[model samples]
Target: METYGVWYHEVTRMKGREWMRRLTLAQKPTPLEPLTRLGELLRIDLWVKRDDLTGDMVTGGNKIRKLEYLLADALDKGADTIITTGGPQSNHAKTTAALTKRLGLHPVLLLSGKPPEETTANLLINKLVGAEVHYFFPRHPREMDDALLRLAEEMKAKGRKPYIIPVGGSNGIGTLGYIDAYQEMDQQRQEKQLSFDFEFVTAGSGGTFAGIYMGHQAVQASSKLIGVSPWLPSQEIKERIIDCIKDARTLSTDSVPLSGEPALEDLSIYDQYIGSGYAKPTPEGMKALQIMASEESILLDHVYTAKTMAGLMDLVEKGVIARGSSVLFWHTGGAPGLFALQERWSEWGGG
Candidate 1:
């Protein structure tokens, strides 16, 4: 089977089967555009894979790619309701709700944080889609997962077939989405005669990074995949990514034997950009957000893409990324998150 630029044969043919199981939601092969102005400022050949425009306004973002596979699995299992967990303003949860509603399936979101007094951003969109949302102040992050499973059981007992999706859809099944994405990217590169030295992406839940890394590995590509940590520590994100990769390998219809197990050395994760905490707006991140908006009319969310851009700029400034080397910044999309941080926007006088 041929997809994007990849001609799947043998092991890749098995991978294509996994992708064939997915239901289409995203506008496939999102634009790969040159950030000419930003590239000039940084003195590098910089480009962007616009995953932000993957879906409609509310359903747009990187999460939609994962949801295509996840929701398809839910339907295959005869699930009538979907249960997922994420932060209060999670783009994943919002996209899940939007897509689930479109498919005529119920959505139950177990969000980690206190309910806001005034609904806005993702929370507002969730309500608009009529998703049943529950909030919990967990002592540990694992508690949210626990709550999701328990809720699914309760729904099952009440005669509803519920499917549980883990936080950020960062599981073996969802990771396949990005494996397909890598193929799409390679197709674009071949068509444009572009050569990328590095590919930078945000490592939030690790599935996106894992899939991209494994996709590159599957194709034996030379470009280095650098994951910028937006939430977890570098070590933790690395572990999660490795785990996801292993899981994906096992789930594939056929295995491609490796000389040795992929190790930490095989992956590159930078955690320096995660200033303060996960959702907190860092000064550097805010500046990066402003630059994209001003120069390219591209909106980025404070939680993910902004921090990732900040890391990219910092690496360029530090001489880690050479001036003439080509770089591809994967835009994962979380622009609606900007509206969720009204107070921070006011404090920065961005309004």
Candidate 2:
């Protein structure tokens, strides 16, 4: 079978066509290094991929990589306004606003979570960047999609060009961003002569997981990609991610080609750290935030990244990996949302 990823050359050329066209992006090959103290604590040689430093103006996260392609497409289509929806404290929405403002595109953000009492960091930033905020009562996660579609139709009726980016940028096109990260790691492994036993990440919308899964399959990377699910059961997350991978594989191949039923055995999804539900931060996640910051001076958010880090720590403690086995933890930033719960953080001694 032909390889299932874009070359850096192709990745650049593809950037200026279709949705990827007109998408010039900032540099974001974040440093991957060993977390010596935390690794010692867990008895594993743990590493961290610092996506938290990936973008400018606190738009830090794995989402910037995807936005590079997404916004390019929007501009290519001559979109005047960018409309995206998410929770009140969504990292994705906040980053979308920041990037849109930086590129001179109008931003319309729809928020669908609890209304904050004061100006939380994300809310403050959204207003500072002049992105319109629309609120909705906290409801089932599925409601956000309905809201997004309805708003798109309304914008269409008004004759305004709107580009709707799915929550967390989970679609096939955006998922390609993560696949590019895999390519970066492949090059890093060669340059550093690192034998990465496994790659770890917080699995939120499954786009990141799907990218790593498809990239590994295409490049035959030796590292195993393990997804720590912040929400949803392992089985359900795997099914959703598998479907995304299938679609992405088709996109990469330019058509649906012969395949062996989405070979995803190397993908492991663990759901041990999700305490209450989506958006509900856990005590363990809080502790992880404290521990990582104090030990490595690395900050982790409570919602997804810290929870996934907590799971990685647990896996290390239980010897699920191994002593001295190299593992990379992908930090999918949500730190701005940290201020949204500063009171909780102070109470829990997380400052």
Candidate 3:
């Protein structure tokens, strides 16, 4: 197996291809480290893929991986401004704002929900990065897409080239980022002679899970890909992932190949961790965050990673994952969100 660097070079060498459209953003091959004490507690040989360290201090996260491709496509289309949608404390919105600023492109965010009386965490970062933010309470999340399209049209009428990035940037282009990531992980596995029976990640917009799943299929990896949903129902996530996989197949025939369409069974999204609803802190998730912080010195956010950890722990406790099994947890990065939910943290025994 070729190293990630080698594989990346080969893929990018296809200059004219759509899948080749990507900007260099993330620090590649984010360290895959052993979780010794945590593993012992679960009775599993656990490892973590540290995607939290993928970029700049404030902007680092799995979102940057998608932005590398999404933003590159924006630039390629001669877009001077980017229009995207997300929740107020969205990591994707914050990363898009930061990266767009870094590349000298304007960012306009149409955030869902009412504007907060006070801004902090990702919202504060978005402001500091100088993104133009608009807030609305959408009747449905899909309505945000329409809102973004209308905004893009208005921008175009003003003679500005505006690029619209979907919520979570889960499109075919963004999914390519994780396809590359899967190859990178495979290379790492081969280099270290590591084998994991299961690979886990938090699934929100579904693009990340789709990309990873496609990548796993592309590499014929043996591990089962598990997605712990912190938002959306399992069926909804499955549909979105299936759509993304289809889009990814159309985008990257050379890398991922045009295999048959992935079935619903191809996805494994667990919605049990989405307690109370999106972005709301759950007791199990809070406990999971405490466990990670206390045991591994790792911080997980209430909305994503902590819930994912909670799900993983639940599986272990239920004996679904056998003792001594090898597991790989993909840390998608949301530590910054901790500050956004400080009040909730206080309730979790932090003050």
Candidate 4:
């Protein structure tokens, strides 16, 4: 095992492959600190990977990791404008908007649903960064993907070199970010002499999970990786992760071959935590937000991380995870998106 420091690396590329290109974005090697309070409450050895603090507070999040590679590819292609799709209050949208602007590239967001009367949370940041947001009511999300491509073509016709990123930046190239992240975490784990029995992460787009899966398999890691999906069903999540892994494998074929691609049955994905639907807050997730904040002094957004935490808590309570097991929660960052649901805070609690 080799030790790597910080996020900075020399200009790395395999020919003109976008997946191989990366820009330094995150603070690197985020703290893998013990969550003693939460651990005691859950009766397990709980810890958190503070990826929420990957960058500055205003633009910080796990998405920055993916953007480092994705945006680098955009710049490599001489892209003046970046386009992506997400919900109206997506953290990815806000993060992309802020970071792209910092790099002097314009961001255009194709968001589902109409603009809200109150521009708060991530949406507020999108406005602050002056991101060009196109609001629409999409019956299906694929419509937004089509819109994004069309928007890119329109921009190209206008002499604006545009780059299009899929929802959540979860593509083959962006997936490389989390592969690096897994190595970083493994290095920290080796240093601390810690080995988690299970590692949990919010699986929205599946790229992050796919990258980590690839890294885990490459290293033959002992800890089991459990992905808790906030939106997609178990089967769908598995398919998306497999797709990402497939696409990512196309970019690099080094000595450490990415063997053992997870079959559908091999994946441990739980979609039960999704109470209602995508982006809708659930009672378990809402309570989880309070529990994490009170116990660990950490905020878990209701849309993603909270649901993942909720799944872990439920598993622990049900004795499925076994008592005294070591568990690590990867905080992929989405606390700002919680502000959009402030109106329902009192209804959910805080009464």
Candidate 5:
């Protein structure tokens, strides 16, 4: 029942059965540790927000922050079953299943693509959670969305209450998660009297970055917010993030409304890190993953953090981020995704 910061009104006042409520799912204020080894190597004062440690290895990840709000809303509505959709290795879907089961709600996941030959990482976690999963290859992403909606309708006809969560829990309600996260980080900054020149985070479904952006503007923080995309092109990713901010703005005044679609000068999101595409590992991405593991003894997944850290490294070295700058990387906790790409484990330019 304790509110973190600015978004307390934004989150608890949502139109629902329990208007003022939030399920305490993830650990509050994950540690912001200095990356001494990586900092010396990169010639920058590097720090990592260990959001990856928010939960256990199986269910721990950034997704839990968002799910805390979303699942709470579902429970408030008295839903008996929760329906959600995502790719083969969606952290959000895996978190949803694990937590929904914990709350005594049936989790039905509509995952993209046929089941893999070996169920690893998130897929393995999905199975362990005993979630009802259906795999398919949809011609379009919207097709999967439609499938989820139709499935919910069918469940409703069968006298079951189904609560549908969009991919990545990337909605206005879910955006509250990262907003609170950003507030927590700000609180840490004020307490430690540390000033970060650049704050870097993985820009995937857009909600996480948007929420952070919202919180950044709300608190008038001076850290330069940058997003490294693991998916979507530059323009498309910008649009998605803008849409998320807009959605959040509708629910609360904390988010600054864009006037005439202001240029994204404040928000610097780059698609260059995407390398190939989502979930596909690149040489730089793999090398970055390996570097973090070797230098800091911290593991990063090939899908998300690997590329994000890769981009941050390149920017720092290229003098774009400045050599002596203080940098912070938001580790969004998708390391388990490495097991799914087992065949290419050593293909990141390693002998």
Candidate 6:
């Protein structure tokens, strides 16, 4: 327990639960279902954490889960406006706008991607929710963060209480959402007597992975977390996750000791899956989407989770992971993007 940090006991038990309650958060635990066909294809026992079916704005992605906690914190702090950023067709931005609108708070989206001529599906959805859209043509990643922070500061100067959710809501409180998910999965495993050797997910901002990592430590689950990085280098993702775990531990109570240095599992990220960069889908990703939908009757978006699936398949084929080991693919969800890729699927006999 010595390594659990100073606030460990208070932070882990009632304080963590209390913090969650204060946020008016929705605890929608997603189902952990087995992917029978996918398992057969990979020659492994495969399961999917169906976060895509997360009960929200009509079966939304993993962002909705994080948003439940983050927006709750915003409301708890009496935030009048919610601010966030992502790509033009960002699922996070769209979901934030929807949830903020539902809570009667103004949402401002700062997008760092190509401006749409007719607007993407997510853009139209954001518009419906009355989110003010701001676009910045940033050729670099640092510029995007800078633009978002600068805009938030300007809002503060104007006396607006702006709650800025980081891109994908990948922060401490945001990460707690996945910790809750880990517990949910743990329960499912117990009921079914399932033993997973590892779980796979696509890490965008690293909070999800960090949360799972910490949650595993907390629950004493042996399942290894493998993150397929959609963006950011491996070292950067590892460092960010470490920092998040440190902060989470700092906020936790002393009775829970995460004795080891916060670290990511022995993970592999096939950077090739990121075709042109973030937001652009790869050829293999498109193929994977078609295969998954056709074989498994599941839809995957081009950007985040689909690419992760493609990578997972590749790893399975290459024997990077043992073939027969039980694996869970976190279906992070962004199927709205499939609408934008109609042309790509047209050749594949899209309905």
RMSD of 5: 4.2
| Model 3 Cα lDDT, one tens digit per residue, 1-351 | 121122122224253443466667888879899999999999999999989889685746899889878877787688999999988898898888887887788999999888898899999999898999998877655787799999999999999999999989998888888888888888998898999999999889989998898889878888988999988998888898888888877766446643588777768889998987888888898888888889999888888999999999999999888999999999999788788777666775454
- Which residue runs of candidate 6 sit more than 4 Å off their true CA positions? 1-13, 16-27, 139-141, 252-256, 263-272, 344-351
Locate the minimum summed-lDDT window of 10 residues in model 2.
1-10
Q: Candidate 5: which stretches are off by over 4 Å?
A: 1-20, 253-266, 348-351
Question: How well does candidate 6 score on lDDT at residue 177?
Answer: 72
Against the hidden reference, what TM-scores do the models get? 0.91, 0.89, 0.93, 0.93, 0.90, 0.88
Q: Which ten residues in a row have the lowest lDDT in candidate 1?
A: 3-12
Per-residue C-alpha lDDT of model 2 across residues 1-351, encoded as one tens digit per residue: 012122122244332242243253545578878899988887777878777778677655888888877876676677878888777888989999988877677888888865677887888999898998888764644576788888878888988888888778777777777787777877776788877888888888778888877777667767777888887777767777876676666455322233565644545888878888876888778888889988999888887998898887777778887888988888878888888887776654464
Error of 3 at 49 (Å): 0.4
Global lDDT scores for all candidate models: 0.84, 0.76, 0.84, 0.84, 0.82, 0.75
Residue ranges of candidate 2 with Cα displaced over 4 Å: 1-11, 14-22, 138-141, 253-258, 261-266, 346-351
lDDT of 5 by residue, 61-171 (tens): 788888877887787788989999888998888888988887778999999888788888889999988999988777654686799999999899999999999878887
State the local distance difference test value for candidate 3. 0.84
Model 1: per-residue Cα lDDT over 67-134, one tens digit each? 87787778768888999988899999999988888778899999888889989988999999999999
Across residues 173-268, which tens digit of lDDT does each residue of candidate 4 receive?
Answer: 888888888889889999999988999998898889988888787777889899999988899888988988888877644333554566898789
**Which of candidates 4 and 6 is the stronger one according to TM-score?**
4
- Number of clashing residue pairs in every model? 0, 4, 0, 0, 0, 10
In model 3, residue pairs whose N, Cα or C atoms come closer than 3 Å (at least 3 residues apart or on different chains), thus clashing, are none
Instruction: Indicate the TM-score of model 6.
Output: 0.88
